[model samples]
Target: METQLGNGPAGIRGDLSATDLAKALRQGWRDFAARPQYGLFFASFYVAVGIGLYYLFMVRGETRWLIAAVAGFPLFAPFAAVGLYEVSRRLEQGLPMGWTHVLGALRGRGDEQLLLMGGIIFVGFSFWVIIAHMIFAIFASAAGLGEGMAFLTSQMGLTMLAVGGAIGAIIAFIFYAMTVMSLPMLVDRDVDFITAIITSFKALSANFAVLLLWAVMIAVALFAAILPYFLGLLVVLPVLGHATWHLYRRTVG
Candidate 1:
């Protein structure tokens, strides 16, 4: 029988290797295939959210909204995977799938752990959005607040991209460390958000190199999948969501 991860300071196996990533990917694909309907249903939320944000950004023509739209989906992805985690968990337990059961799992054992974790995600994203606007403001002032392709191609504009991208990457990685296992652990166990966060940090710190590679894989795949207006999420989101649940299983005990 699989060991249940403890509520406090959950033990991390800490020996995850490259092979485990591959195996998890395979299992994730199998899970998606076994229940494509659920995958599609869950992934559709991401697609719709992505498109709506993009539309609002394009329509309003504001730097902050544009930054939010571009960065929101990628950074907020872990939270969106809750349902997929539920799906993968059910498949693992050979339990029947249903919309209500999976959706209720987002409430997370009725202890509000999921809600806390979600707040962290939202605050982190909001901070990034603010920082992103500040970065743009500096560059925009340099360009005399001119609005055109000219500034975008200028050296100052390029520097803004580099700086903003670097800071955003750091913030994203921090959230990744926080949520990579916490979300699945929350869905699978009845722990508080603090324990889940610390356990997640322990798991990442213990296997830094391998897990960093896993983060890179997620970033690259998500970038590619999101490029085509999030259509690829219908496949990529579920696969990664399940793959993450599998990874969580191996890391946290």
Candidate 2:
């Protein structure tokens, strides 16, 4: 019998190459340039959120919220990319590129599967924040270090950072494997969330090296984008979001 996941048919998996990364980036740039308004419009949401978070944490002195937001920020990227995916999809299909069309795609036909996937992302982010808090408590107490930036200047703080970084990497890779293509697949097809996630894992397994490289590139780009008060995300996020759609196209038949 043919493989099936949930109520939807399985997706066909394809091979990927390092070169595809460059190609996807080029196409993503083209798409962004072709529709600068949409790219900026979608990206502005992320910028607004970033600035809002900064205002809450720094200006208003909400350190707890800051910790949670920083820990969970990565989880927001895939969801934010949904609009860019729609934009690319429309561009690829030669469909109308109006705000109504692009924004309406966000409704996603009331698809529960996309919501399911989003729930998973949120859960993963919540888990990470909890883990981060625990790690902070354990290390900070042990080292007699106080909370906030003071910890970073001490040995215990450095150790905590190291341990947290290692753990965060593992979690991030697992999430990346699960959703790298699943989001686009979810938007592009009628597949169940589970199937889309499984297909994403299989694609990562089959093309581990290239996909890992792609993941690393994404991480590095995001880190750099975040350094400048998250303003850089205005450009970086949309490009990466559009590139991801092309990458999904190349990886899934």
Estimate the overall C-alpha local distance difference test score of candidate 1.
0.85
Which segments of candidate 2 are over 4 A away from where they belong? 1-14, 60-68
lDDT of 1 at 248: 91
Task: Write one digit per residue (lDDT tens) for candidate 1, span 98-172.
Answer: 988888888889888899999989999888888888888878787774544566678887787788889889999
lDDT of 2 by residue, 13-125 (tens): 44567788999999999999999888898888888888788887788755545665665586778878888899999999998888987887666657788777778888998
Give the CA lDDT, 0 to 100, for residue 224 in model 2.
Answer: 87
Model 2's alpha-carbon lDDT is: 0.82
Error of 1 at 35 (Å): 0.9
> What are the lDDT figures for the candidates, one per model?
0.85, 0.82
Could you say which candidate leads in lDDT? 1
Model 1 poorest 10 in a row by lDDT? 1-10
